[model samples]
Target: MIEAVRVSGLTKTYPARRGSAHVVAAKDVSFSLAEGESLGLVGESGSGKTTVARMLVGLAHPDSGTIVINGRTRERKDHGRSARLRRAKEVQMVFQDPYGSLDRRLSVETALRDVLRWHMPDPAKGTVRARIAELMDYVGLSEKHLGSRPHQLSGGQRQRVAIAKALAVDPAVLVLDEAVSALDVSVQAQILTLLNRIRAETGVSLVFVTHDLAVVGEVTGEILVMYKGEAVEHGATAEVLRRPRHPYTDMLLSSAPGPDWHPERVSELRAAFAGTR
Candidate 1:
């Protein structure tokens, strides 16, 4: 299979605040996604997962290293017409919060229409509505939800709408940044099923960025574990989850509540640590 997205030694740094040192968001990160494959990027906050997501979707440029998509490497100066258009059409992102990512002012139909118009403009105008409906169906949404605004829909419905919008561009790569973290557990499962279905039906490569190991295990075949702005461990999802090689990865897995685990025990311990603060 052809590689859909490739990153080698990807690095990013932010300028320091008044009294702080420079912030390194990504450090020598390297990975590759095959066409139609789903890879999970797992880590805690400030682990560079979101930074990698942003760079993958062209929202941020790396300070050094390379990002190759569909055989073309993205350079800092490639923000020209052709590059921008290609990036928009071939790569897309689904953010963590559907409410924040979507426009409350626009109806679901209008939001979808705007994306289709921008990315798939060559389609006949008369066929756009049908295409929109098809996309809605693909994401398990219906026409009734189209007239509703983001605020009017349930969390799952709003996320489904967001997925539809991302698919509007017929993108080859989908960067999902904490795509289901805000939804209820059941809703998260539904969204995961929907995403898996979409991947199976459309053969689009997926980069799922999240802090949840269980969620990642459910959907992704490969896993990359990040820590301190770098990838500490990476391998098959099952392998990594079952036999983590890094200390950070082990800590994350250990922290999750297991079948025989007592949640209250940890809560009490944490509370005691706080010392009535």
Candidate 2:
């Protein structure tokens, strides 16, 4: 299978503030995604997964790394507006807050049409409308809702619109940084199911960055477990969840709420693992 995304030796650090040492967000992180494959980037709050996602979508520039998508190696710095727009077509990110990502003033139809026009440029008059309808349908939204703005929609509906807008560009890679974490449990399930169907139909590679292991299990086939800005484990999702090799991975899995979950044990593990890392 062809590779859709490849990241090598990615490292990013923030300068020290207030006389403290510099902060390292990701250190020598490397991973690959085949065409149509989904990989979960799982970690706690400060594990650098979000940093990696930001870099993948060109939102953050890495101190050192190489990122290649769909046979194109991205330049270290995007040179101009044209280059940035080209990168937008290669990789799109769906942020955690749907409301923050979208414009409250624009209707859903207008938002999608704008993206298509920007990336695709001067499609036939009826083509844009048809494409907008297709994108809305892909995200389980109907034509009636096209006139609604972000404030008029529920959290889940807004997120679906966000996904549709991201898909409008026909990006080779979709980076979802905690995309479903803000919704209710039932809503999260629906969004996850929608993502799986979208992947199946479009064959777009996915980098699902999330803290919830259960969430990743629904959408990804492989997993990369990160801890304290480092990749501690990488393997098949089922194997890693069932039989995690790293202590941090074990702690993460055990920390999940389940019939067998033990908070005391998780605390102990966290304390024990802190020294090892």
Candidate 3:
């Protein structure tokens, strides 16, 4: 399989704050994403899920690790302009808070235009506008929204705009950090469906970071369970869901919200995950 993303021994630490000792946000973590495949990163809050996701997109620098995207390995030691551009093309991130990520001043069309203009200069105005319109359509938006700002749209619409912005970059992979968690359940489902369709159509690999296991089931084929800054278990999402090997994985699965959850599933999960470690 062609590897779109290969992460190994990834680690990050922050200096002591509030008289506390230095904190390790990620341990020697390792995972891989095949080209056109989606992987779920399931974990609790403070489990370093976002830390790992942020590192993939250069939001948070890793203390030590290898991040190879689309056959290009990013040298953490290098801070050159060409390297940054290469990494940007390899992966883009859709943050949890769509409203916060979008510029308050930029309208829907202008926001996309800025990215296209910066990335590809000398394009005729007609070309830029046509591409921007295409992007809006791809994300299920209409040209009527072209003049609207972030605050003017609904939560789901804003998120769709965020997706459009990410797609505008034409990245090979998308590192989504709780991209749909903030919206209502119906809206979340809509976003997930859109993402699955987008992946099928574009063949862009995805690293979906979220605490919700059921949501993981909805979108990913493989799953990695993280706890306390470490990846404790990983395998087929269905296998892990039906037979979690790590106690932490079992706990997360049992605690996850479901549309038809019953108390008995918890006992079943515990027994299935038990003694399998």
Q: Please write out the lDDT profile of model 3 over residues 1-277, one tens digit for every residue.
A: 8889999999999899997898888999999998889999889898898899989988788889898888878777657776676677788889889876799999998899888876777986598888898899998999999999998999999999999888887899998889888999999999999999999899999899999887899999899888778999989998999998778786776666677666788777667656464
TM-score of candidate 1 on Cα atoms, chains taken together: 0.92
Q: Which stretches of candidate 3 lie over 4 Å from their true place?
A: 259-277
lDDT of 3 at 194: 93
Q: Candidate 1 lDDT, tens digit per residue, 32-133?
A: 999889999999899899999999989999999999889988878986777887897779999888876689999998998887777666887677899889
Q: How many clashing pairs in candidate 1?
A: 0
Cα shift from native, residue 219, model 2 (Å): 0.7
* Distance from true location, Cα of 232 in model 3, Å: 0.4
Give residue 272's error in model 3 in angstroms: 15
Model 2 weakest lDDT span, ten residues long: 116-125
Query: What's the distance in Å from true for residue 67, model 1?
Result: 0.6
- lDDT, candidate 3, at 101: 71
Clashing pairs in 1: none
Show where candidate 1 strays beyond 4 Å. Answer: 262-277
Q: Please rank every candidate by TM-score, starting with the best.
A: 2, 1, 3
